[model samples]
Target: MTVLFWVCTIGILSLFLIWRNHSDQKKAKERFRDLKKTQYGASPNRNSGEEALSHVSHFFEDHRQENAIDDITWNDLEMDSVFARLNYCESAAGEEVLYDFLRNPCRLNASERARLERQIELLQTDGDVRLQLQYQFYMLRQRGKFSIYDYLHLLDQEKKRRNGKHFLLLFLLILSLVCCIFSVSGAPLFLVGMICVNMITYFQEKGRSDAYLSVFYYVLRLLGEAEKLERIHHERLQETFALEL
Candidate 1:
């Protein structure tokens, strides 16, 4: 009787956790879509391709300057397309170059800085273009530098959950042995211990399984984000400096 009660309790808790994880994933996809839309609307000089992205970093750096560019001119820049480029191109120079540039656009030479300045100066003539680019640059610059360590930490957490699962299994196995011993010896209370062990084991496995799945999902998400950034860099670099060689 005790073992039956334990199994029932653990089964209920496990079901709840699985449902929660599924709900969270649905919410995540919706949020990412909205984020992509917002990023696109803030981009500049769509017709000019990646040339606009260099200006994009600048526009983000100084939002006040965004007012200098116009709406029509700003709309010409396709933020989504740049994002798509970042998503696709695998070349080190393509998407990777932009990430490298963002890591330290400050290291650029006097001539390079001057050229970017000249470009921005020209873009500022339009009110919408200037404002849109400024916002994007500001936000991205603040997103801070990417760190591999941070991602690694997320990975470790997932592993930790997986490791814990083994202990739960071992506990139930031991309890089962005790239950068998009690049955033969006519020890009535041993049934109670067996029940407790079964219930705890079931609940623990469910929780750990959900956590492991969540961690794997997060890893996939981060990779997708990295891809988005990469594509933008590749397309933009080609347009801005014809760096395709």
Candidate 2:
């Protein structure tokens, strides 16, 4: 009777976990669909169109180089619409790269352009491959507009000094550990006190560190996305993935 009850309990728990995961995946898919609709949907007004145009223009202005595709040409060619059509990228970095590619038409020679066209054709025809890539990108998408380069530049501008408070906390933590190992009578009390001090110090220092921490988080996320992309075995994207690495 006990064995049967334990087996049933494990089975019930497994089912519950499976159901929860399925539900979460369904919600994620719905959200992704909604996002796609919003991105590609018809604008409700001329104002919205102008807003989007301005946003794109501003992005180019900030990031453009001498050889990059100019605003005038981009507008003339209706490349915004083109980008919307071709953008199946899941990550912010991928989207930005696609935007750059569209705006600053690379000086690809005839043979190279043909090869690219063939790769694009492959991407279009292979739904499974596209879906896999999109899933990867979705996993990598940030909650807000994150410009990697901009954040990196900000990180560079930050001072290189270490916080003495952090060192003090670290020393206390080590001392507390040593006390515990030596079976010191007041070790637990000292550990608790050190924890409280560290918590107070942490909150006080958090404001200054938040920006740097956010940049580090995004950088780590980008690296993870790149690693995933590199693992995907799509011939069309082989060269592109290599470049990303």
Candidate 3:
């Protein structure tokens, strides 16, 4: 009866989660459509804190070239608010890239400028292709409090993670399995104890590495979205962006 109850509970929870995901996706699509049609004015940038906003700027600040916009000019233009107005990006990573591009203001040659203009036109007119791409971007929501680049920087400074503890845990689990065949009662206790220890250790490592893991996950998501766009094969988009991904 308890087993049946758990099975039923799991089924219900799975259904609820699926339903919630679909509902969220529908809402996001609608919101994108509405914003595109109405041309909503930009509000102030979402600031978790001064520290977080600073972290978001780290990449652009660190990588400034000779031609990059000067701080004085940027502020004089109220570039932050201008960025807020221009940023239709769905992901924090997208926002970071846009910010960096604006900061570094590249000089596009005639061909490049024409290509960019054509891509912009496609995005404006091709609703289906635009929506498909936007949906993928929407899935990669903002990472509050810190940018992915910040997490990556932290990872670079940290010592490389070792697999020794994981190997030890696996060895113990195998030993416990062997003991189960020889001594059932003793083996059960040993196995349970080792399982508990493994759980504790796993959680400890996960807690310590969560930031690093999230950064990698976010990057993988961006790659996946790019891959999705590549598969779309929209003729005009192909000619314009020339997505090589």
Candidate 4:
């Protein structure tokens, strides 16, 4: 009877998980369609263009790296419209990286550029590969405008602020469990108390860490996307994907 109950419980949980995943995928697809419509209709006016240009200056100043393209070059080349047309990226990271690529075009050698062009041509022709990559990216879309890089840059400060209360609480909980198992008087009550204390501490710590949650979420997504991209049989993307990984 116990085995039957356990089997039924597991089956029900599996079905529920499948249903939830299907529902989430449906919602994501709907959102993707709406985004496509918006992207197609988007037209940045003079004011909007100026605003985008201003933001570009900040990225340049914040991240001083080589091969960075200038805003003037992008504007002169009308690459913003070009990017909008080609921007099928579904993740925040993918979109940001694509924007950065356009703003600061990579200084690829002639052979590398030719190889990349070939890969682009292949990507254009391969609908299945494109769709697979798009689906993966779509699932990684973040809920808010959180910058992974900015939060990562502040990791040192965050680490410095961390106290060892969680570790102490965990140690106490383990000791309480051992005492309860040893059949000591009042051990059960002590164990329960420790559990409550641990729960409270967990929530408090979780609340404190909530600010970094979105940043970490997007970073995980970025890593997942990079892993998927690496598996694609494209030599041109191998080095770039390696750098990302």
Candidate 5:
């Protein structure tokens, strides 16, 4: 009876979680669409501080070279204000990419420039593709004051964990659940012990690699969205992205 109760409770909770996630995602997409409609060509309303702006520049700084704009010249040109004026990205990653583009103005030849212009033209004209890509980026939304690059740097310090113990614990958990169903003597106690051990192991692993886990999730989300982008079926956009689908 207790096992049945637990199973029912877990099933209900899982359904609730799935429904809530779907609801939230739908709401978010609608909100993003409304915002995009209202804010098109409008001046940016985001208040960017020096620290926040600096965080966005981490990727650019990391890959910056001799031809890149120097700090003195960047400040002299008041590029921060310029960045804020032009910034309309829905994610930190997008902002970082834009920042890098601005800082290292690519020396494109005539053919390259024409191709880039055509890409921009398509984005401006193709509302469906534009909104689709925007929503994907919006799904990759920034959280808090830190950029993805910040978490990525911290992730470098995190110790990598092997999956062997995790798999073993999972197998043991399943075996214990089966034992419980068969009404084996002391099976309930064994199941409880397995649950406790699993909880402890999970938290210990999370504590050790919280940063790594966060970054890994972010990267996975990014890649997932990129894959969706690749499936958009626009030949020009596919060429522009140059992603191997």
Candidate 6:
């Protein structure tokens, strides 16, 4: 066979394999999201879940109506309440309340949601959140380059690395992978580079759950060959809720 013919054939096969893998991964993600909706009995990202999760309704019902939280500021109390619930104790009772509130998720106004996000940021500004997440990573360190905690900490995700060292390492990995690919057409150097890049990107986000997911994905793929996946709690992903896990 001609050299060009072989090159074309190999290139086509590589493209086919890469595309297949990507399609499968995306499908898995969609299926996972749908499963979550079913299990939580609420739609993803919808506040409907929060409404059903409220525990205060009963308490407040017995109290005088004048002191009841009004529509405009109830969201604030919810934010504070979630924070207070998380920080003060790692109690299942509190979590049950959160779940109840989230089950019929309250419709937090856009401004209110943004405010809560800021509140989460301020709370995490001290760095304890990151450390606890890190400890989770180290605990699951045996799972190769990734960890279970990575899937749970989107807020700790590493940013895409832009540093000179990263670029240099990436360049070297790419060069070596390219040389190897052409010389030994069956190996997966490009995929290796992708794995490295994913890890780097995971760490760059630092405090994101996406970072944790990156590590989780890496570990699962490299070690566990895991098929099941779940999202971190909304608070963990957003730094909004304190968690015992």
Cα lDDT tens digits for candidate 6, 1-245? 69999999999999999999999977765664454335432223322244433433332233324434465565755654453433221222233334334423454567777877775575457344433333333323233222233233444554664478657666766776776767766347665766678578657656544555555555554232211112333454445443323
lDDT of 4 at 171: 89
lDDT per residue for candidate 1 within 49-91, as digits (tens), equals 4553333333233322323334354357644354544432222
Give lDDT: candidate 6, residue 9: 97
Q: Worst 10-residue stretch by lDDT in candidate 2? A: 44-53
RMSD of each: 16.1, 7.1, 6.0, 7.4, 7.6, 18.8
For each candidate, the alpha-carbon lDDT, in order, equals 0.48, 0.69, 0.79, 0.65, 0.84, 0.47
Sequence-dependent TM-score of model 1: 0.28
Arrange candidates by TM-score, highest first: which order? 5, 3, 2, 4, 1, 6
- State model 4's lDDT: 0.65
lDDT tens digits, residues 1-245, model 2? 99999999999999999999999998987786565556543432222244433333334456677888766787798877777666555555665666766765764678878877876776567656656666667777643444555656677687787778689898998899899999999999999999899888888778777767877887788788778778888665676333467
Can you write out model 4's per-residue Cα lDDT over 1-245, one digit (the tens) per residue?
Answer: 99999999999999999999999988877686565445543552222243433332333346545767676776798877776665555655555566666665654678777766776765566655555566667777643444455566666577555458778888889999999899989999999999999898889878977868867776777677778766777553454323344
Backbone clash total for model 4 is 1
Model 4 vs. true fold: TM: 0.56
- Overlapping backbone residue pairs in candidate 6 total 46
Candidate 6 lDDT at 239 equals 50
Highest-scoring model, lDDT: 5
For candidate 3, what is the TM-score?
0.67
lDDT of 5 by residue, 1-245 (tens): 99999999999999999999999989988888888878777898887778778678888878886788889999999999999998888888889988988888864568877877877888888877788888988887775566688778776676766799999999999999999999999999999999999999989977866666777888999898888877788777777756574
lDDT of 3 by residue, 1-245 (tens): 99999999999999999999999978877887776556534454455344645655777876788898998999899887777667777788877877887898774568877887888888878877777777778778888767777777777799887899799998998899889878867899899989999999989988998888788898898788888878886788787788888
Better of 1 and 6 by lDDT: 1
Each prediction's TM-score versus the true structure = 0.28, 0.57, 0.67, 0.56, 0.68, 0.24
Give the clashing pairs for model 3. Answer: none
Error of 2 at 3 (Å): 19
